[model samples]
Target: MIASPSTALVTWVLLTTPAVEQPALGTCSMGIQHLEVPPVPREKLALVCISPGQTTVINFDADLAMDSMTLDGAERFTKVEFGASTVKLIPSEKLRPGDHLRLTVRFKDTAAPSSVTLLLGVHVAQAVPFVSVLRETRTVESYQQELKTKNEELQKCIEENTRLQVESTGPGGLAELFMLGLLSDDGISSKLLHKNFVEAPTNALSATGLVSYRAANRAALMLMLANKAGMAPWTAESATLTREGKNGMGLRVLTVWQPRPIENSAEDSILVVEVKAPDDLQGSYTLKLWEAGGARTVTLHGVTFPAP
Candidate 1:
């Protein structure tokens, strides 16, 4: 009864050769691993890969993610595009000579969940032609700024000239001149009148020609004197005439005056008139007169004279 037990046994066999490991999938080699394109004129570069069938994903450095690259603070590229095993780098704009570009590339194996990352560097060189272009651009900009400044100055000058013209030709301009002792009815007497009416006449007057003076009358007298002196279209400086109170003699007028000569040429000229007023008729007056050396004859209209 004790010897009735049964047992089962298993046998094993040994092999002499070892098993070989399978190769990894999605292995890639770069066709255009590095880049060295002229940055100037050309803004784009194409990066190609030898393994076209494999899926490719491109990643850019954080610093290089900008719309454009910069060299010495100048923008170089505006955009970037990635394709299957190919990447296109669009430049921001034309590059200059001596500009530098630095970029980092990381190649990942998308097919495998666990893959090693391959790092690559891309560099683009600057060209001589683009340097010249940059220099020319700078020069042109500088010239443009200069021209603008000069144009502004010229415009200011033109405006000033126009203002002076208006003041000299406006209303009461001739009367003011007359009160300053710059006008008279007599030709010879008008020539001798001083700018200051206070100065006593060296010679005795035969008669007082100016009875009641008005701005219109002064203008007419100026035209007439110009005609009589054989000088057509006479002109005068603008002046401000103010009534200083009447004395024992007549109405007193005050103005600071300077004598100018009338010329026969078409060029604008100031006619110097010398005349005498009463002793008390002199003081500072508000008047502005411009020397019309090269200006045209100013038309007389819409002038307002001060109340006497």
Candidate 2:
């Protein structure tokens, strides 16, 4: 004998409707020809709020079974809680409000008629407000771009300043400090000026004078030095001398002072002197010399390289 058709309505209470249906089927088959369900109004809306540092709770109408309601936008469902007829969807913390989702309801009851199913559509109402992370990422990227631009500008400024400084101080500004008296003593013009034989001319030859020659200009003198031809050079700085006049030739002597020593030895000494307007004058002038206890003079002759 066929049993009477049983219809049970679940109560609307509690969070998610845990049980899928009432009156366990116990492996029974039924072809539900038709299913007529009343419209679940929007006024009967459900909401789930997930606040920071708290678990999310979703409450829905109890008319639907635990598996009846579907979450369309959820990536992964955590744990589903079910009550009498209501169902709750617990999703990852990534859920937020205003996101669209669709719900489909289905079932089978063979005792009704032929195979039939029931379906309903519900719009998403209120949802949890996830911390807006995309906005924060955009802000960070903008700040990084601005910082990069500032660093580039600073580097450019430094490079330009360095270039200007290098140009202003050229190779000619190194040394400018002396004069040299090149006196080929008698027939010993072939004499090699060794440190041992030649002293750092402190006392000019007083009894016998000597001829003197100076570098082209102060800039050029910075590169010339005394004892330069010797194996070891003399590193003296400021130097000058003048002697008695003889036969329209003014005697020229040599005087020298020391400069601050340099480890490189190249910056040690210099000869900065220039003849004013007399480049063509090759007349003999006595070199006014001052020895330890004597004195003398000689001629400083030169062929002019045509006045500049």
Candidate 3:
């Protein structure tokens, strides 16, 4: 026969040996959701999460065992306790901009072959003024270097100008000046030559102009003029002069000149110079002119005139 519920429970309890109460096996999972170390100025960081139970014991990995953990006021700790569901880290010193914290956390009874690692990077919220100042200093230095280079170039140009001015005032200066002036863009001197001398339209006789010589030392003046006019490329053929008559303190002379052939023309050109010189002069007072490359006049004085 079936007994009542209370009677059956009592009988079952009496017949079976008394079973002891056992504690439930608990579990925990720990991780970090965000790895940023907050800029709270010496505040503790809740960087680790422990779910469902209080951690009875905590340990660090072998590599981080000695001095890896630090507290806000305490230097280092191997084991720390948290009665709550989360673990908080305290720093021994206030965190500055760009500071980094690295550590490993091994949870008790966690099903894993290795522990979790934590890397906390800290950055200041405000702008750093020193960075701007450094950039401006570099820019100023670059500008100063550029200015120094420009000053050096300007000094070189000034020196060159001075040297040319000195050369223009020397011995054959007048003759050189006259030749350069003929080539000048104003065309005043060329027009004057065209007006005074008989025009010969030939490739060799490109252009002609006249100059006056006062002494018998015509060779020196001719060499100086050649050097000043940069006429090293042309060859001088001959120079011939005919005496006209006495004029003032010197004899009137006419010079017939020829030079080597120039480019763009098959034949060479002839030049003429009319000058007056003292009768006692030993050397011939003849001036020769020719057009070389780029229509520049090449001159040689005291050269022998070629046969007609």
lDDT of each: 0.26, 0.26, 0.29
Judge candidate 1 against the unseen true structure and give its global Cα lDDT, from 0 to 1: 0.26
**Tens-digit lDDT track of model 2 for 101-125:** 4433332222212211211111111
Assess the local accuracy of residue 188 in candidate 3 as a C-alpha lDDT between 0 and 100. 17
| lDDT, residue 168, candidate 1 | 55
- Runs with alpha carbons beyond 4 Å of true place in candidate 2: 1-63, 96-98, 103-308
TM-score of each: 0.15, 0.18, 0.17
- Screening candidate 3 with a backbone cut-off below 3 angstroms (N, C-alpha, C), the clashing residue pairs are 71-90, 71-91, 72-90, 72-91, 204-268, 204-269, 205-269, 239-304, 239-305
**lDDT, model 2, position 266:** 32
What C-alpha lDDT, on a 0 to 100 scale, does residue 275 get in candidate 1? 16
Highest lDDT scorer? 3
In candidate 1, what are the lDDT values of residues 170-254, reduced to their tens digit?
A: 4433343444343345311111121222321211111111111222122111211121234344334332122332311212122
Q: Rank the candidate models, highest TM-score first.
A: 2, 3, 1
User: 1-308 in candidate 3: lDDT tens per residue?
Assistant: 11222322222222222211111112111111222222222245333322111121332222222333433322432334432222343332144324545544433432332234343433221111111101112345445655675677578557546634644553343344343231123211111112233332322323333322222212111121212232234433322232223321123222323233333333333323323233344433323333321133332233321111
Task: Give candidate 1's error at residue 213 in angstroms.
Answer: 29
